[model samples]
Target: MTAKEPSVFRQGFKDGLPIGIGYFSVAFSFGIAAVSSGISWWQAVLISFTNLTSSGQFAGIGLIASFASYIEMALTEFVINMRYTLMGISLSQKLSPAFKMPFKLTLGHCNTDEIFAVAMSRQGEVSPAYMGGLSILPYVGWTGGTLAGAVLGNILPFSLSQALGIMIYGMFMAIIIPAARRERPVLFVVLTSVIISCIIYFVPAFSFITSGFSIIICAVAASALAAWLHPVEGEVADET
Candidate 1:
């Protein structure tokens, strides 16, 4: 008899394991940062649970700590997370017939960067079951790690908690450095964003710009510059 093939859900779960593990470490740092920023441990965990995007959450907590306005927070989050909208559009093409509107709405919450990459890399149409399985572990790991870190932040010495908070920066660098090395466009965009951010933060002329607006400006300006400099070679497909 032939060996049985793994179920699609099982396959997705297996593929998501590494991503889940990675999320735990990064989310731990986020948890520490959140608590250190003056939020309660439960609040930190709640942020992680509700907003799965790492960068957005980090920026958001900073804004929260600085007592930014609701509009600033909303705009900043919308700008940072706009990529997910694009990712959702791309994945729409690959959804199986069984992946209906309700499933799409539910799973869209879990359509994170890593998850999007994994889903896009798969062969043929992706099923709802597979997406469900892929999301479970990462969600748990992120939330669980935040809970662990937030609680530990209360118990650990202040210096140590501050040190642990730096891990998230390292994680972002690790992610960006490799891709930036491989692609000139990536490098250019990264450098441009960094420069713009520095200018906004350090230049007295731009001192009036709040942290939240500064982030929005950097992201939009860098991305717009990159697109102008290196436009992708594709025609806009018309939706009939």
Candidate 2:
């Protein structure tokens, strides 16, 4: 690659490298979990590449392993990860208006939170191709770590494995930490989730709804409350 290309690529890599380091442990947990659930290493890796989402990947693996129907799988994942649709729209404005379908088809698969945050932070045009490279490396790394973890997990004791699994929750908590600091509504939503999760855990009758459904319900409810409490800025209607 050209020196200029490397310079152009450095920003996305810098943005994603920390995520890559974090994914080593977290994705390793996913890999081991996938293996423990009887999925193969290659399958786990493929899912990581295609899904590029932690919650959605876990849900898909659970449903796939459980022999969930296509409709069930689709609906569960769609509800859980519908945030990507909104995120995509927001990210699209960063791209040139001429961003074509082929580029979208190739790189759209890797539009995760880290990529979006990094891409949006840049002041000028972030070459989509360079961003794709930055995104792809971590994707492979996350999947690779998982595959390695799955293979190693087969030999490790259950206690050690569970301890290692805490990394995934820790990574999520890291995401929540920054958001909570920046946005009051985010903190409120998190608190709301905590309350709802307690209710879900304690209330026995509602157990029929899966984690996927719970996520959908909570997001919808939290969004409604956030909107009601904090209406869009400057949205007062002007009367003629």
Best by lDDT: 1
Q: Score each candidate by Cα lDDT.
A: 0.81, 0.72
For each candidate in turn, the TM-score is 0.68, 0.73
Clashes of 1: 0
Q: What lDDT score goes with residue 70 in model 1?
A: 100
List the RMSD of every prediction in angstroms: 5.3, 5.2
Clashes of each: 0, 0
Pairs with backbone N, CA or C atoms under 3 Å apart (clashes), candidate 2? none
lDDT of 2: 0.72
